[model samples]
Target: MKKNEVPQDGDNLVKGESNWLNYAVDQNGEYVQEISVGWEPENIALEQAWEVVNEKVEEARTKVLGGQLSPIAFYMEVNIMDIPLLANYMDKYQWQVRRHLQPDIFKQLSEETLDKYAYVFKISRTELMNVPTNKNTK
Candidate 1:
């Protein structure tokens, strides 16, 4: 693609900022780095990916509310993390993190443990403890 051919079709992911890096051919017939506002295909792909993420998060939320899983599961889905990754962040073993995903085990967690999770998720302890009741709440 030529530098001048780079798409700037307007729908930016970050409000008004355009920070997508792309490579294109310059007038000199050499490769050049270009900054694009966005591309239609890339935007569509990202939208689809977010839709999947939202679906998973919703599924986890329902499970938590039904006592099938813990709020940790919901937040874990929201943060796009699996047990192993979450355990790495919490400095815990995968088995221990998996146990915390249980509703009963979550209920028995101490303030210190909850605080550590909240820190990883960048949310308040209260937010970490409570799963959003609806999509709007999230």
Candidate 2:
């Protein structure tokens, strides 16, 4: 589908500007430099994919608010990462990652460790500390 047909919805995966190669001839019928353009396609599959993501986010929010899991664990769930995956990303052992899921242990993490987790989650340490409240659950 053409770029004009791309959907603009809450579930849209491609919301902002994107690049696409254009191969159209110039007015003089000569090939010009390829220009960047915005392009995206509306697909039901992508919409459904976001639905699953939202469900997981909700679940994580619930767990965090209920005190069943720590804020870090909630972020892990929202980011769709398991303990093993996060451990591999952080270059720590799986047991270390699991221990960090405990509220007591997470609270004692050093600034460097917090920075590592924040970097992986693409959030700041402050944001990581502020777990989503129940009211903000979406």
Candidate 3:
């Protein structure tokens, strides 16, 4: 597909779980089973799997959002000056580079951590990408 082509709404996985636990009666007022409670993972791999699944899901979401805004999006190249030069550097540049920071902040803040300090703010997609740069580093 071309870059500027309009996208058809594909099948989107409506994200999130349903509240299957809370239950009562439907048409006939009957007692329903309470939400089943499950014990925590007994091993390491099971716990790690959950974390990995969540990470991939969030990454997919970011990709979709990035695609939708790509036409109007501008990406800025950032070189962190404070990062000490690594002795094992192999790339052409020695400084740390970054393109996105909002996602970084979001990832850093857990659901609980973010809830404590979270404040809503309005921002355009351009602002999220740092508004791009015209100057060449070279």
On lDDT, the leading prediction is: 1
Which tens-of-lDDT digit does each residue in 1-138 have in candidate 3? 222221222221312221234344544555554442221332244457656655543443454356532211122112111112211221213222221124554344344423322211123433433322332211
True-structure lDDT of candidate 3: 0.31
Once fitted onto the true fold, the runs of candidate 1 whose alpha carbons sit more than 4 angstroms away are 12-14, 26-34
Instruction: Estimate TM-scores for all models.
Output: 0.86, 0.63, 0.20
Supply the global lDDT for candidate 1.
Answer: 0.89
How big is the positional error of residue 38 in model 3, measured in Å on the Cα after superposition? 8.7
Better of 2 and 3 by lDDT: 2
The digit string of per-residue lDDT tens for model 2 on 14-127 reads: 544444455655666665545343433344565678778777777777777677666788788768888999999999999999898887788899999999999998898998
Residue 124, model 2, lDDT? 89
| Positional deviation of residue 12's Cα in model 3 after best superposition, in angstroms | 29
| lDDT tens readout by residue for model 1, 1-138 | 999999976564545475688899999999999989877787788778988888999999999999999999999998999998999999999999999999899999999999999999999999988888978465
Off by over 4 Å in 3: 1-43, 68-138
lDDT (C-alpha, whole model) for all candidates: 0.89, 0.73, 0.31
Task: Point out the higher-scoring one by TM-score: 1 or 3.
Answer: 1
